[model samples]
Target: MKKRTAAAAMFTVAILATAAYAAHPGADYIKENGYKGPETCEECHPGKAKAFLDTVHWKHASKVTNVDGLDPKKEYGMQNRIYVMCNGNDIVNNLKEIPKNPETGKTKFSGCNTCHPGDHLNDVGSKGAEAEKAIDCLVCHSTAYDFRKRKPMKDDKGRVVMGQDRSKEAALAIGKPTAKNCMVCHEAAGGGVIVKRGFSFTKETDAHAAKGMVCVDCHKAKDHKIPTGTDPNNWANDGVRLSCADVSCHGASPHKDADLNRHTAKVACQTCHIPRTGGAFAKDFTVWAQNPDKFYEPTTLKLEANESSPVYAWYNGTVANTPHFIGPKGSKKDGKSKIYPFKIFQGKAFYNKKTGELLSMDFAPPMANGNTRAGVESAARTLGMKNPEQVAKEAVPGWQTIYFASSHLVTKTRALSCANCHAPNGVLNFKELGYSDKEVVKLTSPELFFNKVAAKMKEDW
Candidate 1:
């Protein structure tokens, strides 16, 4: 009888757990009527709408048109014609406008606004009018706006099929923006969570966020441009500037240990801070040599992160330029720069064998194009759909690399130890980083400790 009573209690607990998981009518709420643009929102909350018009998110996701055929900001190897034809030439307007086959008037780019909400069908052009139309405030301010939408599937009955915007329903019932809202783009980036972005940032974890200080606390935007660069106007260098040494947040003398303080100039605050990222699960990266999966539904998710240690590099702001790969700028010798931690995401994109150029794939949204005729024509997919028997087809599989600045997951513990990089078994191959193993070992030897002590002694005077 006691055992039976215990089983009943367990069943009641299971029901409550299911209710929590199915947190509905609150957020990720599907709007049957779809998203209403920023203009309509301005009527109720004029202040937020007027101010949000100037933000970097607005510019990068909405304002800037891919006018320069040569530069797509970040290289994906996919050519403009193939991308434009699939996602449509319209990079201007948000998602209210879905790109149609100018000939057939069928949907083309459906899930383009998964990151930036609004219309994509209408051409915003160089003019700001169309760009202004795409701003959806619930994206940033609403606590419930989880970045989700219906998978672009076609109806077999020849009926006009339409996708969904959960944010529209989410916008109706709203509150102040939380870390959850910011992660709509940050975490769900690069096709999946923990795939890209610095530290796979999440609200529930991270040191500052764990305490209660949210993203906006440090990353305060003035007129929507976040100033992280050496120079304020240079908005490109946004995320590189925050430090514990800064006067506003934490004063210059934050460290109690004078010995550790000397390493400040050479090493970044995050180098010692943010130790491990992702809650319970550590961060990692991988690329497919063959059988690449779809955009969002990547099957190769391993709970363990790729590298136990963050890659050390001299970070200034932007990464060093390359034909394909770009590294954040940091010099071994330059005093202005600091040795920072970086998260490396390794993935695959097709590359031309003869020319040695990295090939590109059209990164369409998750489950966007299935077996539909439009899916075959878009080229947004990789060769995963192709028969395995025809494996070594035309384009030879090549590897790709993405570097993210590892500064977000600011935890008090979990820093890399001396052996993690200096020892022979370390994650970083010294030779790959342009150094001999013995030389780097000697460089990180006891002398670094002694130098810190001496600097502390001098400060005492």
Candidate 2:
């Protein structure tokens, strides 16, 4: 009968293309466990791929060496816009080879491969061997990594082809790396965890990830470096980077008040101990309003959770606050400026109403690259617009705030006491915190400044 109706229409188009390849997001965990990338887990994990290629998360994908420099007239006395570095050019060298945007086919914003997914690495000199998407390391040592339910499917030589043996069943969901493999790109940081990481890393839990600790147990690493302790003289240089006071897990005066341990020489034990975080995700900004012709993809967004509201600034962790916003110096008249505590975020942007400016300079990650949708259409294609929501109603609106310095929650019963900033509807506003209205009437009359400091400590004892 006409060859059995063309063999029943090629067996119903091969069972509807295998039910549209099991609808992605780890596509049946990359087809029942298989992702042999990261070079077959570096052939039996070569010392965890040479200590995860000296991390910053596998060199944040590619090209990095712009250690965010500064000098602003021998230290913050004025103009240099007080240290905010997404890379303020110490050295970014030629570092090219991003290519792809033939009119937004998209790919050129190298703020680290949009968050180190895979298939890059072969620049900065060439002994070239890796890059067939070499560091997928089962998207961080798999907990059966569904790699954000990956729906990629490219091929025709465009690479990324997850069919069949799925890189050998994603190498049987690899071996170790939990904290659910580092919150699958850190709880969608800046684009997920309720839009730029705040309290509760989106839901992966913290307080040392619910008391089990991992993020390589306080970011561990030896000779391959990765310690980034942000200097206490390079935390005694065990290749630098390790502290919560060098992981005694809090004991360099874990505070029982020596006047909050004499404000840690201008504050920074995450400023008055994590006084706030992620609250309904402060000014959510709809996860940075992506849509340069609709591109925001944390595997197809839905995120909106948010929370946090602890803003009290003056950080002095040097210049533009390295690795983005160091909450330790708001120089309330700079005696090495202390008075810290900030988590602030308040949003609202899009400017340039015929030369009002401020459309994107502040977006900075070569134009806003937190986790990358081509760094949000390369800061809306470097603000030429092309239709970032048709230039948002002929644009012109401001307010940014940002200031993270949000060190994770530690909780000595939610800290922040001493009348939550010497109350009077507190949280600091002493003439918008420059103080001196006689120090805002002795910090808003705290019971007559503690009854004149308890009658001048009973007339100096």
Candidate 3:
């Protein structure tokens, strides 16, 4: 009795599942019409159908017009002029038919329409039309179209009107179009086929692709209007404005001025943000090799200082590994002393041993005249330092401040030292450490702490 009950329950569940699937209109449509082709859709959407006939996809699917100075029927032994590699049953032998140009009298096999199917056919079923016009939205968008359930108009007596239901069957009906469906043809050797204006037939295989993001997600109709170029006016639809810094898929902004979020006005996001074969590129900005692990955060920083005191600063970061800095230097006390030693002036200044001059200093106000307040006024002036300071604060907000005591004291010389700015971990941790990492890696000896730190940064950081 128990076994019989279990079998009955399983049978009931199967029937319910079948009924649920049958309810979906798409499934019913596919059942009735396998794939009738674009002609069925033309009956309803004539305008769209007309536009589709002008595309390249329709031309590829059509029968060969001429062959070898003769008709396709005379040239090829096949009954039909178009000899497609049929996946269906009835594999006819030697059915391959070569296409020819009627005007040039030259024989051609297959063209662009072989892959882009939309451009091969015409609305009127004519062969003279250009192939590019066949790329109809229905070929890709109409996943299913059912005419069986379509109801006829009702009369005043609530009876179905005769000849009112003019529902036509669809062609190539099946599952809905998805990102996976697009990839079938768009993908090429190792990656998606990139086309004019930075468009790709397939989605990128970077981290975003791995996460299952589709091409249409970011490159929506609105976003596609912007073409890749220096001149913004050339862009279609007056250009698409998007925040490259805010794209969640890419994670973070790669620009120094990313925090300002002012990129939308000057250039489209794809101009600098899109992935290229070599790397990312911008007009006058530096480019980086393809890096899949780059990360960014939207943040800001504030710097304040006094004449004798170090500058205080803070940041609000989203992720870990945020960078920080400390004091600067003035004059050297000993002959063999390192310019920016950890201790010495309690981490206040980094001195130069040769000329007994300060190499770097922490953030401090310039010495003010007696008329102005000494510490307070000088601190205010230092706080207002623009350009590099403002740029840095915007790039990485709340980042620790390493103030150079006085601009006049140090020689404004920039050194490529790992320990200087990066310290124990240093910029070596960066996937691409610019030229500074390469230079530092070569100069230091193997046993030196700086060398170990650089190696460790490369390994751990």
Best by TM-score: 1
TM-score of each: 0.59, 0.30, 0.30
Clashes of each: 17, 33, 48
Task: State model 3's lDDT.
Answer: 0.28
lDDT tens per residue, model 3, 266-334: 222332222122201111001112222221111111111111221211111111111222232222222
lDDT tens digits by residue: candidate 2, 247-272: 35675666775766665665567655
**Most lDDT-accurate candidate:** 1
lDDT tens digits by residue: candidate 1, 1-461: 99999999999899876664464333332344444656555554465544554444543422212122234354222112222112221131123323433334344333333444333321222226554554555666665554444323345754323333435656655554567777766665444555444354444447687778767778766545554422111223223356667798766556787645766767677777755533111111112121233322223332333234566667665444333454566566555677776665454433344554443333332133222222222332343433322221344444444455666667665655444544557644556555666777775565655666577679988
Superposed Cα deviation of residue 153, candidate 2 (Å): 12
**lDDT at residue 73 of model 2 (Cα atoms):** 27
lDDT of 2: 0.45
RMSD of 1: 11.4
Error of 2 at 100 (Å): 9.8
Report the alpha-carbon TM-score of model 1 versus the true structure.
0.59
